[model samples]
Target: MLKREDSAVSKPEIQKVGKYDVKEELGHGAMAVVYRGYDPFINREVAIKITDTDRGNDKDSAAHRRRLFFNEARIAAMLDHPNIIHVHDAGIEGSYCYLVMEYVKGAKTLKEFNKKNEILPVEKVIEIIFKCCKALDYAHSMGVVHRDIKPSNIMMTSDMDVKIGDFSIAQIISAEVTQIGGIIGSPKYMSPEQVKEEEITSQTDLFSLGSVMYELLAHVVPFDSENVSSLVFKIVNETPLPVSHYNKDIPEELEQIVQKAMAKDPRNRYPRGLDFAADLSKVYRNLKRPVVDIKEQAKFEQMKKLNFFRGFFDSELTEVIRAGAWEQYGVGEHIITEGDIDDSFYVIISGDVLVKKGDKAIVALKPGDCFGEMGYLAKTQRTADIVSLTPVSLIKVSGTLIEKMTVHCQLRFNRIFLRTLIARLSKTSEELAKYRPL
Candidate 1:
């Protein structure tokens, strides 16, 4: 016989919920216990969220929790997006109710990365938040306001994919509030309007997302306090320290994006999620370094290990990585031709290059060496014909892009280029001296 338990048991243990077998506990929150459930009928794994109505301090509070549980199911069912968690089914059996949702194995909350003492790579942070913006945009277009947009509610899969979940507190843009003067959501990430118990809109989500992004980049909540009242007060009246203040590595443009999104006045914040996403896109594109995707990131990492980029700041290195393309050439391939009018500089990442004066090979340049800079600097034709001595990997930087670098970055590059040129000249002079018979 199957045993049934509802409300409370001396030992709180659950084995089944509806048609799903609850295998193990995934996580527990103030109002629900999530389990890794197996759907026998569908032959698939799912996440079953069981409502804990006992979260309320009083009978009315318990009733409110129950209502919100069903509300979340309804709201989640209304959204369908790759970056938004999908709801499979919701049902109530006896005195228990559960929602079977997409079980993203190995998924962890963004809260893990939103700490005051640590942060992920800036490129990674930007990528994650950009996805969040797109997801929020879709939800807003469907007339839903995700009232509870916080770091913990955002999940990150093992492959770094993002999924926004837990829309239980969400409200329809046109619906009237069932709970008068009610303030719902994580206080720390709430916007000024939410703190003041004013009408909420899509801009509110933008503000919350900004707060989440701020924490990820700076490692601290925009507003922090020991008590709820003080926290709420600060949220409505305070301005957070610029993100760059905490992480000097953060660029001024990125900090400005965060500040604009977290503006105290909702009217001043981004009008739509699309607008917010656009701003993020602009910053990501304009960054001195590329954090665009995994492939680009791998290339950037390769540049960091090379000796030529040793003096470049991490930020400047990113600029260098984005300013050029990493390319490969086969042996006998011409890299530069004598008398060719071009100003592109090249750095040997691997393999070798042969520098030839007309028909004779003058030098064999190895990895970490550079070529064509003399012509590039002089804005003239190449003085030597350069060819790949073996299969080669190289970075070809455009003079046009290099000109756009920050003054400091450009100055550092020039210093290194000068040193390299001087060394090469000295080597050539010594070799020529030996040819001059006594």
Candidate 2:
């Protein structure tokens, strides 16, 4: 759950904790309350996490809770990853123990992205998981296991940067085992080993991360039940519905990645967090990146407005858009050289290019103009050199991609090429007549 400063319960809040002054309640989890705080000496805003001790029944329970809070502070302080939340200070004052952390205003948790009807975009989800994987890798290298890796513990900044928070249940492998056997972590996101209360490892974090990714992409938890018993039973014995069953748009490759991460046996899951991150990075590179997509759409729209495509249907234009690759050339850069045997064409989106033959400037082509049609359509050697007269944006269409176009689109393209060829030949004849032997 994400609680903004404005939506705080309006109850009387803590005025101060050590050197920091509390501004308001930011959020509250079962074990602690997070507060918006201001550090006076540093004049910086911070988040303060205070342990909730009211739930402790006796002296032993209260000490156990305190130990848990201190354990979190120690574990979090040891981590120095960008994705992992930074711990600034921790101290105990009377009955209250608090930790000062880096504050992220307007921050939301991954839980918000898991809404049934409003899941996050697949790319965004992949990026979040990728970051989490690296963060976990760093923590694991430091001999720490964030036993409770779940959506609510992963915070998202206003700019969509991920911050993996809440290490209250973390286990430091190098430290003496003070707590064990008792079940820990959220049941819904737990690994099969966690459900069975078996010895946990770095692989446990990957399993929980897989659950978080699944919820974000498919808008449903991998294992859900009305009671803890059934939930634990399912996690230990059942297989989750393939993510594609819930969201078909999710690629099969991505589904397989998620499945392997959430495998029932630790041996089947990624060997390390770095391995998981590597797979996510591959998906990131292959997916239509947001920045690239925006630029491509702009090119597509420009293509639609050109006279060359005026007669083309929307479907045909879309095919062309998919077939073409955008490229840029600097002034004096050669696009096509004379006598080159390449079957590709170019259309100028911006700037100008000079068509040259035997060191003679033939003609200058500007925006919306095309060259190399003869080479592309006839599969012959280039007759001239096309060099950029100014910095240029060009759409390059390869013969291979064009060959994959639908029959109707290919026919339309061929007709336009023929018309363009005739027009150029006619102009050449007129020039030849003007230059006839005098």
Candidate 3:
């Protein structure tokens, strides 16, 4: 049995409801317990959400508290969209009111995806959010507003199907609320109005959706803080850095859309879900075109900052930059295998590469770090496997290119090459000593 909280009893201990027999406890929230159950009548599996009745003890009593749980079920049952999880039934058995919903196997939340630190392709992100937009539009048309929209509430299945779940904080537009400062939603995804405890609109949902997209692209939250007070202050008053600042690969049009969606003023943001989806579609189309050579230009800009190359003549530095070629590799993909005959030394342009001797990793190479220098100097087989730890980009200078350059300018090449080789060997020896037995 999979329980959200470790202290909760296993699913078999939970009493059966109607024809459904609990198989496993999937998760538990503030107001309900979600379980994987077998529906004997239907001869299939379903997710059963059981409301927590012992939440409050007053004249209003447990029944009054249970009504809010049922309200969430009622609102979810009315939402019919491919991206929305369908509610099958809702009923009370003794003290528990349970709602039966569709069971999606092998589904993970956006929070789980972030743990992997993957930078999603722009097209795929747009596709996922397009489905979310349609679902929100449909929910809005039915006069329902999802007050809580966060990464944990959105599920991505194995086949990449997006499903929105957890409608507990949803407002029915017609309902009269009594609790002020109840603060019913996730803080990180809340819009400015929600933070201030003001009336919320469809624009609030769009604001949350934009935050999710921003995180997917940049691998960081819009406003980051370690403490609760600082986090709240930044979310309410501070503006996030432009997405392009972190990830240069993001299309400019897409960046603009994210910025507009997260605009502090609701009026400045997209008016409706449809408008947001339309902008994303347009950006997707533009992204399919050939990318300009901006990355190469960035490399030259970086070279200008290097102190080692500062004293070199412009023509010499330009020649060295022109001789380099960009190479990319997936994590664990071997850029250079130990004992292989190779004459090229690599300068890491971005990301990290792991230097491995046998099955153990020796060290990681960050931007500006060079590898295979020992081989280049000695003209021998590679001493270690250089594998990518993340998606990596490097500038490769082939043995033949170095040879040609050395032939043209022997004195300069000898001075620089010998110094680089000696430094690399010294570092390698120091690293090896750390791993050696005392």
Winning model by lDDT: 2
- The model with the greater TM-score, 1 or 3, is 1
Against the true structure, candidate 3 has what lDDT?
0.74
Displacement of the residue 121 alpha carbon in candidate 2, Å? 0.8
| lDDT (10s digit) by residue, model 3, range 155-185 | 8888887899877668777657532125668
Q: Cα lDDT of all candidates, in order?
A: 0.81, 0.82, 0.74
Candidate 3: stretches off by over 4 Å: 1-12, 55-65, 117-119, 175-181, 289-438
Q: Which pairs clash (backbone N, Cα, C closer than 3 Å) in model 3?
A: none
C-alpha lDDT (0 to 100) for residue 77 of candidate 2: 80
lDDT comparing candidate 1 with the true structure:
0.81
lDDT digits (tens) for residues 56-153 of candidate 2: 44567677779888888888788998789999999887556789999998999988877665568898898789879878988999999999999989
Worst 10 residues of 1 by lDDT: 1-10
| Residue 157 lDDT in candidate 2 | 94
Clashes of each: 4, 0, 0
Compose the digit string of candidate 1's lDDT tens values, residues 1-438: 113455463223678877788888888877777889899998999999887555334688678767887788878888999899999999876445678999999998998876544468887887788879879989999989898899889999887889999988888887664632378889999988998888888999999999999989988888999999999889988788888888999978788888889999988887877667656655664463343243767777877878888877888988877776667778998988887754469898889999999788788998888888876688777888999989988887765557556899888878889999899889989989999988
